[model samples]
Target chain A: MSARLRRLWGMIRKESLQILRDPSSISIAFIMPVILLLLFGYGVSLDAKNIPLGIVIEQPDTATQSLAGAFDRSEFFHPQRFGAIQEAQQALAERRIDGILWLRNDFSSRLLSGNEAPIGVFVNGVDSNQANITKGYIQGTWLAWLQHFAVAQGRALDLPVAMEQRIWFNPALSSRLFLVPGLIAIIMTMIGSLLTAMVVAREWERGTMEALMVTPLHMGEMLAGKLIPYFALGMGGMLLSVAMALYLFDVPLLSPFWLLMLCSALFMLVSLAIGLLISIVTRNQFLAGQVALVVSFLPSFLLSGFLFDIHSMPEWVQTITYLVPARYFVAILQTLFLAGPVWPVVLVNAGAMLLMLAILTVLVVKKSYKRLD
Target chain B: MSFFHILSLARKEFLALMRDKRSRIIIIVPPIIQLFIFGFAATYDLNDVPVAVYSEDRGGASRELLARIEGSPHFSILHQISSDAEIAPLIDDRKVLLVIRLGQRFSADLQRGDPAPLQLIIDGRNSNTAMTALNYLRDVVLDFNREWQHGHGQTGPPVKLEMRAWYNENLQSRWFIVPGIVGSLMLVVTLLVTALSVAREREQGTFDQLLVTPLRPVEILIGKAIPGIVIGLLEATLIIVLMVWFFEVPLRGSIPALYLGILLFLIATVGVGLMISSIAVTQQQAILGAFLFIVPAVILSGFTTPIANMPEMVQWLTYLNPLRYFLVIVRGVTLEGDGFALLFHQFWPMAIIAAVTLILAGWLFRHRMY
Candidate 1:
């Protein structure tokens, strides 16, 4: 036991030196997180604002002008005026406009006479999420215009089925709240798996694995030694991630700091284990790096519940997500960051992370070579 | 500039790529897996949204409302909530995405022609889902109200909103997303192959051997640039084929124009890859540098999110990404059948990007030639 500890100590020291010497590794470990967080936070948004809503009105009068004005006034839409339906259809095809609001010549007369008038709202529904939001915003504009019209006429009205909607966790409907927690999970996956995967595969590629194999070192000691520095690096990256989430993006960290850290640490260990196992199996830096990305980073980004909700995915894909430990990590992170100390979710996801860690650790041990064949 | 010298170098690159069995599998396998994963996973059409309905009034009207919520494919009502205490835990657990609370006066108010207050409590951690669910619920309630008014011989409001979605009538997210996925896959595959090529040679000390050879710098540059462009074109073609034949996204645009866009886009990406390669000293550094470039390019490229939705400064920054323009071109061509004449605005930006990057890569190569 003493001998194993001493060997692990020496390996850790050597591995730390290698990590320190490689300037690129250090940059990847630290700088990449900041870049990813900023890109996701500032650049990627679900809120569809400034949607190009083309408006076509023939012979515009006061009522038609106000109707167009309603669309123009709304911050959600950038209402561009068009002269003809042909021009509007061309804009729709070019994706220059998300949807079009065509008011016929009879609209003004219909509004004055209190007759049923329907304005044509032709949307570019290729991007459905944006299209759905566009529909909602247009509806809101219509309601706003009607309320103003009713007020002008001095008509008191009572409506059936008043909808009082309340958003609980993120009241302002900021996309950051959803993306930040998911970004942390994604960053942690890269830091833990990709970095560690490269480190181990690099040792093999540089032919230092042969030397380590000749020494009186246990395989477990060497594997853990190679992974320990990266684990610390990943934790540093995690702190940087949470700090960015809290300070840079102003995402509320609702749960206890310890609980959040605990979840991050667990997920980090699983990712590192995956990297170590891939490095051992591939035995080449280039192959290992590619494999790590395919299995680790890509899956974490796509398969994890970070970007796409797992509940909405197809059944086989959902089953595939069960194998991706980042999904569980994202669940934990989202709960901790958005909803404070949701214990059952934390416990379940943590247990899943530990199970994956156990499986990956066993694979790492099995794949590590005692004698080079 | 020498034809034979460039040919030999290009052949060497082709050999280097083909020699690796792992890379061979990688080039072919990702397209299929990605196609499958994207087809199934990348959907915004909300399905089976678990909702909890709590009714203080368990009358016929209340039951009908709950039945309405259950009926939509958008929602999957878990169970009726008996008390107020059960609502919080269900939402907190996320077992129930939303809680519909019906007041005691709901049925009585409905019968007496008074407005019924319906409270929708949504867990807004995933705000997109919450908003979508709310919209679905609103539509269901509207339908129920329309039916009730028809039965009672009452009329709806004056104006009717006749909304129609063009190109994609049902607003299926697949039509919007699949084209971008093809572009994303092409970018990742082509970027990595080129980024690693020169960086690996540098790491292995073979770059010095090439530098000592009689081949001109332009020849070496051509040798490095061609494989990535060819591979990128092939990838773009493969993805387009899958999109048209398999995924069934309509090919409305001119094929020649789409291919022209692909060619220009590849030039830009390959140039970016070579630029990273010239700076990186090792394979690991090359991979990281390439990833650093790729991640932000894809994010800011208007692939997943719209560039117009971003802040003013960020929108200005997206002009630098070639994929952004390509995404527009591909989506425009596929959906709108846009010819080169119609797509002139999208065409010039990508060409400018390609020329600039190629010139930059050449300059960077010359400075770092030692």
Candidate 2:
């Protein structure tokens, strides 16, 4: 074997041993992903189901009862009866209920008299997303009830425009399908950056970096050695996350398995490069961890269009999202998992990630080589 | 437990934190950068959802419908496709989130007072965004339906639902998210500060030196807890100030109520951190432990997603998280103008959490001191 290859192999083996010996590294690579997947899959949902809603009816009649029953039947709402609007308002104020459906005494009378009886929907707007969803659900329930009421009264409920919504990709509209893939990117980001940053920074802090600097190992070979084990560890973590998403969460992997692996490996390289860069610069574990978190993890979590939409952000913030590596990874993962291999989307995103990997590789090599000099 | 001992230890802790200028910057700066990122970048309100239109009907009604869609702030028309084949590429590439298709008979059917089905094909990859955009589109269609009915001399639909959002009239998502960021960022900073303290000492062989001193375990715990609390308060205050002044989220409730919530929340988080520090022999374990708590706590805290939306077991699990209560307290005080009376329900849970975790941490600290 070539001396360079032997040196690289030695360093890789050393890293592997250290990783195996360290319980923290093992937990981070294996255990944390499981916990994160389970927590995010079970605990986080954008679908606001079983929202507690207050129903205020002043007049006890068949129309109001049927309307209340309509609310009761919806999977979206759990309706509670309030005698007065004031009581419902109090419940809303205390957050016991998310919204109120108030029916005045004149509701039935006004409908019978051919007047528009506007039903009041008061939503607690602290969570605007939930509030908007509640409003939409209320409107839908009320509209369906109106159509039923018209049918019961032997009148045709004809509307000029009716909507036929065909939801593609995710038919159930499950947020899990969307989030779980993006989460894989986040998990990879953490594994790739946090572990590498900490380990390399530890070497510097312990003065082993200076010891290594005197060795026959080239800076390139040294970086390669550091990158290889962590890269494999991150990919292992990624596979675990993807497996959980598939079997445990029942999120389908529409793209080819090899394709997913290839892209994930590419993104993992990008992440490791980031970790190596941060570690080389900081050379302090605490500072490196903080920098890695701020530069990689948080951006991956928040700015990568993971939980929030990119287009929804302000223009400048949207531009900033382009700089977050996980944005490309997230787009790639979401597309591959949900929409199969749509080449343009996948290729473009992969290309962006490739560009990033190239740039980060150059930076890491330059910084490490300079430090050695 | 000598108060002087605890006080001096805490001062030393503060000195260690500020001693490293970079560490000092790490404590103060990232939260602000995150504040900006979380403030401006993290939003649910869809500003311009890219849409594509395929209108087979060349009539005025379809034109009016297209115009209405174009006019709404929620949607931006990116493509006007001529053929059915174009729609596939547009959606497949995610170039457009939703495709508005007007059937060839749409205008004729509507003119004959028949219900014209306007087909909307939505990219459901991000179901939340799709659902939100669908809701907005439905509103536009509902408006068009109403206007069409009125123009044809038909009465409006009976039982019109009128929605009025309380507290936030505009329903700005920033108002909700920013205050929650305050709680979460504080938790992170406080937890990291305390989580690293004992672990750092143990790793550096200072725990033995400190143990030989006259300071009792309780005094050390108090000393450790104080710096975390102080740093947490200062960080929270900075974030809160930015949240209110810079972000323009109105601080409607009593300031004391918010501080009380922050204090209890910091204590609870610090307790969790210190517990991790006591068990962890290295800084890495402490960080991993801190992350183990932070991730689950943040996810279940109803910060981005509502607790009501979570499964029953997860919802129950959230009750143990101090962040859950702190979020309610922070968002309630800032947005809902909630006072101590309304916020009391949120306070006691965190107090209980603080008590339990601190006790556990103290015991663990003493056990590990040997």
Q: Report RMSD (Å) for each prediction in the order shown.
A: 1.9, 1.6
Cα lDDT for residue A248, candidate 1 = 83
Residues A1-373 of candidate 2 have per-residue lDDT tens digits of 9898999999999989998898788888888899888988887788878889999999989888999999999999999999899999999998899899899999999988889887888999989998888888888888798799889999878778888999999998999889989888987887788878887788887788898888898989888998888888888888899899999988888989999999999998888888889898888877786687677666788899888999889888888998888999999999999999999998999999999999998898778772553
**B-chain TM-score for every candidate:** 0.96, 0.97
Candidate 2 lDDT tens digits, B133-235: 9889889999999998888998778878878999999998888888888887888888888999998898888988998899998999999999999888888
| lDDT, candidate 1, A94-155, per-residue tens | 67788999898888888778676788888887677888889888877886787676677786
Q: How many steric clashes does model 2 contain?
A: 0
- Best model number under TM-score: 2
Per-candidate DockQ versus the true complex? 0.69, 0.82
Candidate 2 residue pairs in backbone clash: none
Which stretches of candidate 1 lie above 4 Å from their native place? A59-62
